[model samples]
Target: MIEIIAISEAHVESFHRALDTVARERRYLAFLEAPPLAATRSFVLDMIAQRNPQFVALSGGDVVGWCDVQRLSRPIHAHGGILGMGLLQPFRGQGLGTRLIRHTLDAARAAGMSRVELSVHENNANAIALYKKVGFVIEGLQRNANKIDGVYGNVILMALLF
Candidate 1:
């Protein structure tokens, strides 16, 4: 059975472990390499400390995925929330992604956000499909928006309006 729960201090270690696995297997670090294990641990703890909620999907007590609505993107984009979502590779085809994203959207609504946005690498087909499956539409594509391993990758800007 899979369960989604509010992130708590007790879950930090498990969350960190899950993140490392995602980072290693998915090569999802277009923006960040898996940091030192301790740093990754602290980063999540600090983000939670700032009051943005984090949730983990657990299957039989093992962390399988997580999604977070990083609060308050910036001064100009204060009304918008940014997201970082991931699941273990083996868990990809199941409906876990849908459940995780829906949970984040509900959190965004509760936070009074009128809009939510995320940038996906243009090449990440599964993520694009999942985002579209959850009602996020592509707003635009940012050309040469990010450098990954010395190659420029376009970022597809996706949004969901509440």
Candidate 2:
């Protein structure tokens, strides 16, 4: 069974592990590669201390996925948040991402966000499908948004409005 809950400092280590696993794959996610564990810990600490919520999917006490909704810090853009998320390889195709995104949207609404936005690599069909299933609409596309291994990729910008 998988449980979804807010991320805490106690979960930092596991979160970093899960992130590392996902980062090794170049098909999805915004990060070109994994950040160091110490950087991951500092990020988790800042999020938890600020009470800015990020949710995790757990199974057997291991972090299998994470959904992060980070509010725009600029005063004018603070009514919305940008989302980023990923699930472990084993958890894909199990509807876990849809579940995590649904929960993340709920959290965004509760946090008084007027909308949530995300960017998916244009080639990631599964992720784009899940985002659309969760009410995100394609807003625009950023050409040559990411370059990895000398290959440039585009990204589709999507958003869910409350």
Candidate 3:
């Protein structure tokens, strides 16, 4: 059985494990390699302390997918939030990303967010399609946004305005 739940400090370990697994894929996430467990835990702790909203899809006590709506701390950008999402290998192609994204967006709206933004790799057709299906529109294209192993990749900047 899979459960979608709010993030908590207790999930630190499992979240770290899941993150490392996804980061190792080195395709979707920006990280080129798995980060240290301690660093990952600290990051999660800070996210919890700031009341940032994070949700995870769990099965058998392991994190299968996760999403976050990161609110900016600067007063000028407080009304804006950024979305980040990822899923384990076995969980893809099952509409899990859509489910996670929909849940996160709803939560963000209820939290009084005025806008949300996300950047998807330009080559990721499926992700771009999914974002479009969820009401996000392409606002601009970021040229050479990511340079991995001497190869530059474009990014599609998208947003949802309320």
Query: Which candidate has the highest lDDT of all?
Result: 2
- Clashing residue pairs for model 1: none
Higher-scoring candidate on TM-score, 1 or 2:
2
Candidate 3 global TM-score: 0.93
RMSD of each: 2.2, 1.1, 1.4
lDDT of each: 0.80, 0.89, 0.86
Provide the TM-score for each candidate, comma-separated: 0.85, 0.95, 0.93
lDDT of 2 at 151: 95
Candidate 2, residues 1-162: lDDT per residue as tens digits? 999999988899999889888888977866756698889999888877755669999999999999988888899999988999999998999999988988878888988999899898999999999989888999999999899889999989999999
lDDT by residue (36-141, candidate 1, tens digit) is 7678677677767766657889877878898888777577777778888888788888999899989978987887787888889898898999999888999999
Q: In model 2, what lDDT does residue 27 have?
A: 76
lDDT (10s digit) by residue, model 3, range 15-130:
87787788787677777665787887787777777667789999898888899998988999999899888888899889888888888899888888989999988998888999
Q: Highest TM-score: which candidate?
A: 2
Q: Is candidate 1 or candidate 2 better by lDDT?
A: 2
